[model samples]
Structure formats: structure tokens, C-alpha cells
Target: MKEICIVEFTSNLGLKEPQTGKEPGVNRLPDWLWKHNLHKSINPKNIIRVDPPKYSNIKDPETNILNADSLVTYSREQAYLINNLLSANKFPFVLGGDCSILLGVAMALKQKGNYGLFYLDGHTDFMDISLSETGGVGGMAASIVTGNGHEKLTNILNLSPYIKEENLWCIGNREYDDEYENEIRKSSATYISLQELRKQGIANCTKKFLSEIQNKNLDGFWLHIDVDVLNDEIMPCVDSRTPDGLTYDEFNELTSYLFQSQKLSGLEITILDPDLDKTGEYTKDFVNNLTSTFNKHFNN
Candidate 1:
């Protein structure tokens, strides 16, 4: 039996949109999922909470990433906690406040050894601060992990480039700005757009991806799933929404392959804003899907 470690990251400071006297509500996610008995179903060994440092409006002079200093501090703390869990041989199920949490996850794994990244999101998240209109760290997460962003973020824990570009694989991305797309083309990281995923079929695409990862002989890999990857009609709680994305069935199939691959070192779910989940319908549905998927794959 796999011992799951539930890690809650509560921080919305990485959001580009300034707080208008209201919170992003992403911080409420861990508790909300727990209300649905997420941990009970997974039989987690421990639940760890990594609280964010006090947020500040001040952007870093060099990085131009909003709340840069606070994000770094929070990420460091998260890395420490995750590393300890890894050392204990626990599989971390990280519930994130935003996509920026990927930085900390990568940092934790980097300290142990090399790892690949499986980024499943609506957007590529490859923009640097210079190319980013809002300069949110969330938008630059992939770039940071691949050593394409500011040193403050990419060089966390003095480990430059948390994950290798060749080892990074992105899928389920349906939305992309011109600059972001161009950057991805230039980078060594492999990107399979939503259109390509559809053309090849989810099962085939995923099998091929996993085969490549296996062939590379990577130590392990982290999976980052931003909820925005779901169709906007079904998942509208994110701050950024694209028109169309993976349906519930498609997402389940994709994750099923990933979990069964047994190559996943850790997993993180991000960008579900409770503020937009007014009637709690979206949250309930998301929880149901997540639990079903996990149970189908890892609950044995």
C-alpha cells in the first residue's frame, strides 16, 4: 500500500491580479476538499500544511514578479516540508493555492536528484516576467522550472534549473499567447497541445509519453494539474478561463494512465478559486472526479 502525504499550500500571493479588498479564495481549497473526506478516501499517513508568508504588494526590483519575496519564502518552506515527506517514502498529494507551488515541488525533488515534469494545464505557463503582462509567478512557473526565468525563482535552494528542459513534458494546454507559444517552441521541453492530444487520442498520447519517460530512465517525475485544463463549462472557478478543454472523461482517462505509470514521484492540483465556485457545485464535482480517479488508480 502506498502511503500518501497530503500537503496543503495556501497562498494566492502569486496571482497577478491585485487584491481588490478581497482574497482569491484559493486558500480555502485544502479545507474544502477535506470536508469532502478526501484524505479519508486516500488513507493518507499525514496531512501537512505549509502556510504562505505574509503577502506584500511590493514586487521584486529585478524579477518583477509580484509578491516575489513572499513567494520565495513560502516556496522554501514548502520545499523543506516536501523533502522530509519524500525522505520518509511518502507519496505527496499536494493541494495548491496556485500554480506557483510547482516551484517548491520541483525544488524539493531537485535536492534529492533529477526528475521530469508532467505539466497538464490550460495554459503553457512559460512566460518570463518581461513577456508577462501581469508578471504573476504562476504564469512563469514552467519557465522557472526549466531555468528560463529570473534567478530568484529558477535558482531556488541554489539549484539552478529545478528540472531539466529535456525531461519536461506539457500536455492539455489549449490556451497560449503568441509570446508564450514562441518561447515553448524555442525551449527543449516537449509540448503537446490540446489539438495534438485530440488527434492522437489521449490513451495513445499518454502511453507514448510514459514510454519516453521510461526510456530516459529519469529518477522520477512530478505531475502538476491545473484545474483550468478542464472545460470552462465544467470548471469555471479559475482566474483564467479558456473556451474549451478536456472533458471529465478525458481528464479521468489521462490521469488514469499517469497514475498507473507508477513513475509519478508527487502530484499537485492548482488554480481552483473557491470565490468563483458560488454554489459549491464546481468544488463538489471536482472532488468527485478527483476521488474517483485516485481510487481507480491508487486506492488498491
Candidate 2:
């Protein structure tokens, strides 16, 4: 059996300041989860921490994305660490600072071979710099990975477009602005809205994603989950709170099914801000649900 290896990277660099004008609290994720015994429950094969670059609110003048230089250097280091971990045949379960960390994961995969992505988030995260109001890399991460943004962020490690559009499946997106033109909708990547998910059923959606990616015959696929994808009522600790999202049961259904697929290479959970959830009630629940699911599926 493949052993689970945990990668903790609590970074807030991908986000913009909220009304507080201070750095968002996404950096506190790894600590918060561990306090709730998330790691204790999993008893992973090994645990490694990928330190993030210092937080900066100023957007990079060069890439027009916040922390551009730091993110590239950070991702390279992260890619090297994860690449080594995966090389040992351990399942790399990356716990993120934010969606921006996906670049490192993509780079690691690119070095090995072609890979697909299963992107689960409340927002599509595929906006261009022109449409982005805050210039946060987390907001436009989908676009960068698919080679949509500046060459600096997209062409890291001399590899442009870490993930092929047709091989990617962007799911559970409920946030969209009718005012701005939708780019992901027009792209080759598969886009599944929450409404569409309800109509089609979660099981069917999961099966379709796995089936389609398998047909592509890629090396494998990675799973990306931003905690905001859960319903706002139960998971309000996230950075960008929206009106509706997958319920805890729905979240379990989708993730458990996806994790069961043998092609699933790694998973990174992002965007849970401990600064928002001081009581730890929300954090405890999230940890319980997520760890239980992981143990149920893989630790069996």
C-alpha cells in the first residue's frame, strides 16, 4: 500500500488584504489543523513543511500579481521537495497556504510527465490580470496553470502551461460575475457549475471526471480543494465567502470518490483562514470531516 505523506504550507501570499488592511490569515492553516489533531488522526508516513516567502500586500509591478518573485522561488523549492517525496513512492498530501501553491505542484508533475488537474473551488480562479481587481495570484491561479497569464508565472521552470486545458476538470465553481466575460467557460478545460452538479448528481460528476481523465492516458492527476468550496454556513472561515456551496455530506461524496481513483497523485486543501475562525468550532469540524474521509478511503 502507498503511504500518505503530508506537506504543510500555510501561506497567505496568494491573497489580498481584506478590510483589515493586514495580510489575510491563510498562513495560519497548518497550525490550526494540527491543533485540531488533523495530523494525529492521519499518522501520515512522513510530514514536511515548505516554508512560504514573507507576506507582501503590494502586487508585483513585473507580473502584476502579488509576490511574483517570491512565489516563483517558493514554488521552485516546493516543487523540489514534493518531487523528492513522490519519488519515494509516498502519497503526497499537501496542505496549502493557498491556491497559489498549485504552481509548485504543477511544476513537480511537469518534471515527471504530463498530468491532469481536478480543481475544486467556489470560484473558477481563471481570471486574467485585466479582469482581476486585486491582482492576487490565488484568484487567477487557474489561468496561470493553463498558460493564460504573464509568461513569468506561467512559464516557470521553462515549462509553459503546467496542465493541459483538456486534461483539467474545474468543478464546484459557484462564484461568477456576469459583468466580466467568462474565460474558463470558453476554454478547453471542463467547467462544472454547482447548479449543473446538482442536476447531474455528484456521483455522476465524479465518474465523468475520472472517466474522461483516464481516457486522456496521462501519467496521473492531482486534486486541489479550497475549503471555501464547502457551504458558507458551515465553512465560513474561508477567505472569499459566497452564498451557497457543497454541504459537508456533498463535500465528502465528491472528495471520497475522487480520492479512490488510482490516478489521484496528490491533494492540497487551501484558503481556510484561522484568523476568521477564532473559536475553532469550524476548524474542528472541517478537520474531522476531511480526516475521516481520508482515513476511510485510503487508510482502509
Candidate 3:
């Protein structure tokens, strides 16, 4: 049986403030899930938290990014914690503050050796900073990890391209930016649209990813789930809400297949805003679906 380690990243450094002095609710993701019984559901072997620096709404002048300095600092701290857990063979199930947490995990994995990434998010998150409409680093996380951003964040701990393009797979994207999607298409990372994933059948799509990773003989792969990848009618508590995405049934089937892999490293769930789920109804549904899925197949 796989020993799971529950990790909580308490940072929203990647997101833009909704208003002056107003922070994003994604930072509360771990707390919300815990209250909804995600901890009880997993009963993980370990629980860890990486707290963030004080919230700053000011964009960094040097990098032209929001909270650039703190992001670099927090990522380093997270890498240390993740490294310890990996050394002990604990599978990390990370509850993220935002997509930026990927940097820390990527740093930890890079220290070990080459690994593949299965990025499941509603948006590609692969655009350059100059082209960013919102100026949020969270939206550019995919690109940064693949060595497509400012040197400071992308080259954390003297490592660049934290995850190589050839070993990366970007899936479940429905939101589009002409420049962003075009850049991803041109990169080495495999891009699987939400429509394409559904059309190809979850099992087949997942199988292709697993086979490709194994074929490359990679160390293992990390799975990232940005909840906005789910259909908006059911999953509306997200920073950027896109209309169409995978249904709960489709998501369950996909996870069931992916989780069965022994080569899997760990998984992180990001961008589910607890503030929007006022009644906790949607949060409850998300938790229950996730709990059921984990019970049925997590590193099984």
C-alpha cells in the first residue's frame, strides 16, 4: 500500500488580488478541505504545511510579476520539506495555494533526477509574462516549469526547466489564449484538449501518458489537478471559471486509471477557491468525490 503524506501550501503569491488589499481565497484551500474531512478520508501517514510570506499586492518591478521575491523564497522552503518526505518514501498529496506551488515540488523532483509531469488544468498556463493579460504568475506556471519564464522563478535553486518539455503532458485545457496555446503547441510538451481527452476516452488518454512516461524511463511523474478542469456548472469555485470541462464521472474514471500506476510519484490539487463555495455545498461534493476516488484507487 502507498503511504500518503498530506501537504498544505499556504500561499497565493501567484494570483492577482481581487481588489486592493483583498487576498485570493485559494490560499485557504487546505483548511477548507481539512474541515470537509479530506484528512480523515485519506488518513495519510504524514501531514505537512508550507506557510507563505505576508500577502503583497504590489507587483515586482524587476520581474514584472506579482510577489516574485516571496515566490522564490517560499518555493525554496517547500523544496526542502518535499525532499525530506521523498527521502522517506512518502507520497505527497498536496493541497496548493495556487499553481505556483508547482515550482517547489518541481525543484524537489529535479534534485533527484528527471521526471515527467501530467498537468491537468483548465487553462494552459504557458504564456510569457509580456503577453499576460492578468499579470498573474499562476497562469504562467506551466511555462515557467518548462523553462519559459523569467530566470529568477524558473531557475530556482540554480535549476532551469524544472520539468523538461519532452517529458511534460498538458491536459484538460479548455480556456484559450491565442499566443499562449500557440506557444504550447510549438513546445515539446504534449497538449491534450478537454475535447480531445473526452473523445479519446479517458482510459486511452491516460494509458498513452503512462506508456510515454514509462517508455522514456523517467524517474516517475507528478499529477496536477487544477479543479477548474471540471465542468463549471458543477465546479464553480475557481479563480478563472471556464464553462466546459470534464464531468465528475469522467474525472473519476481518469483518476482511477492514473492512480493505479506504481510509477506515480505524487499529486497536487490547485485553484479551488473556498470563498466562493459559501454554503460549502460544492466543496462537500468535491471532497466526497475525491474521498470516494481515493478510497477506490490511490497508488493501488
Candidate 4:
């Protein structure tokens, strides 16, 4: 039996405004919306709600405590929990606060050395503090995992660098500029654009990605999916919305393919804002889609 654990990331400091043309500006997610409903959707039976320690200094207009540079602090506690669970071989299914929560997951899985990462997002999220055009720490998740950015996060989990560039791969990116793209090129990581997915088809892209992971002889890996990767038509409730993203069907195809690999040791879903998710439509769709895919892939 595969036991599952859910890590809730309820911080927005790392996240700034969603800059996509559809929704341009700094946007804060609603308070504890997903946290409340996740149990019913996933019904993990062993769900672990990880509320990261919040900082009291910033004037948070969003009501919820915005834990900023302090994410590394909460990540430490998360690492302990994840490490213990993984020791028993449980499948971790983490929920949003922001994409930055990846720091903790990366740390906890550090012992699975030479692990591969499949990062699915609309943005590269490779910006460093100095290069961050928006200064949103959430945009720097990839960088933090690759051993860049503030020492606090890169150094979290007591691992000098949680992941190596070669071990990382990014899929489905359509929102980034030359500067950030140049930085991404500097890393040994590989990536495919949304246009490429459309051109070649999701099945081909997914098969290629899985083949690459297999070729690497990776013992373990993590799947990080930012909700913004879905086109607004189907998933409009995300904190960030991109117009030219994957259709729900395309996303399902790719996710279903990858999940079947079972090389996926964990799954991270981030950036869903319940405040904007009226009628729980997006939540229900996301829950149903992912759960269905999980059921199909694992044949549960």
C-alpha cells in the first residue's frame, strides 16, 4: 500500500503579483481557502497540515501571515516530517502556499542523491534575488533548488545544494524574458516551451521526458506542477494566469503519462488561490482531474 502525505504551503511572501497579461499586478491569495478543503478532496487519511512559522513584521494586507525569507525556517520543520515519512516509503502529495515551498521538499529528499526533478510551470522561476525583475521570492524557486538565491533557502535541509542543474528538467514554460532565459541556458537543465508542446503534442513530449529520466538512472524524482501552467479557460483561479498555456486535456495527458512511471516519489501543486476560485470550480476540477489521473496511473 502506498501511503500519501500532504504538505501545505500557505505563504505568499515569495509570491508577488501575477505578471501575465491576463492578470497583471501583485496579487495575494485568499486566506486558508485550500487548506480547509484539501482534506476532503485528497482524503489522505494521514494528511499533515504544515503551517510555516509566520513573520509578524510585514503589513500583510491579505490577512494571512506572509512568511518571506523565513520560509527556510518552516522548511526545516517540513524536512524533518518528510524525511521521516519517506523513510517509510510514503508518497508525498504537497499542496500550495507558493512554489517556493519546493525548498523544503528538495531538502527532505536530498538523501536520495542524484534525484531528477520534473518542474511544470508557465514561468522558468529561475530568477535570483539580484536578477529578480519582480523581487518575488516565489519566482526564484528553481534558482533556490539549484543552489542559488538567499543562503537561508539554498542551505535549508542542511544540504549545501538541494539539487544539481543536470538533475533538474523544466517542462512547459511560456512566460520569461531574455535575461532569465539566458540564466536558464547557463544551467545544465533541459526544458520545453508551451509552443513546443503544442507543436509536438503532449504525448510525444511526455514520452521524451520519461525516456530522459530513465536514461539518467535516477533512483527517485519529484514532480512539481504550478497551477498556472493550465490555460485560463479551464484553470482561471490561479494566482498567476497565462493565456497561452496547456488545455485541461493536454495537462491530463501529460500528468497521466508521468504518473504511470511511478518514478514519481512526490507531487507538488502550487499557486491555487481559493479567493479567486469562485464556486470551487477550479478546485473541484483540479481535485477530480488529478485524483482520476492518480487512480488511472496507479490503477487503484
> For model 1, how does the per-residue alpha-carbon lDDT over 1-300 read when each residue is reduced to its tens digit?
568989999878778654655656787788877876777776777888888986655577887878888888888988898888888878999998888898888888888888989999998888767777777888878988888877888887788788999888888888755666887878899888899899989998888878887898887888999999999999998999889999999999999988876778889999998778877888788888887888788734
- Clashes per model (N, Cα, C within 3 A): 0, 1, 0, 4
Overall local distance difference test of candidate 3: 0.88
Among these predictions, the greatest lDDT belongs to: 3
Across 1-300, the per-residue lDDT of candidate 3 in tens digits comes to 668999999878899987777899999999999999999998988798879998787878898998899999999998898888877788999998899999999999898789999998998888889888666789999899988888999998788989998888899999665666898899988998888887888889899999988898999999999999999999999988888998899888888777888878898999988888998888898889987987887755
Backbone clashes, candidate 2:
1
Stretches of model 2 off by over 4 angstroms after superposition: 179-181
Which ranges in model 4 have alpha carbons more than 4 Å from their true place?
17-41, 55-69
Q: Is candidate 1 or candidate 4 better by TM-score?
A: 1
Error of 1 at 121 (Å): 0.2
| Candidate 4: tens digits of C-alpha lDDT, residues 230-272 | 8877778766677878887888889988888867788888887
Each model's lDDT comes to: 0.84, 0.86, 0.88, 0.71
In order of appearance, the predictions have TM-scores of 0.96, 0.97, 0.97, 0.85
TM-score, predicted candidate 1 vs. hidden true structure: 0.96
As a TM-score, model 3 comes out at 0.97
lDDT per residue for candidate 2 within 1-300, as digits (tens), equals 788898998777888898657888888788888899999998887889978888888888887788999899998998898888778777888887889999988888888788989889988898889988888899888889888889999999888788887877888888766633268878998888888898999999899888877887888889999998899999998877899999999999998997778888898989988888989999899999988888888634
Arrange candidates by lDDT, descending: 3, 2, 1, 4
Q: Model 1 segments beyond 4 Å from truth? A: none
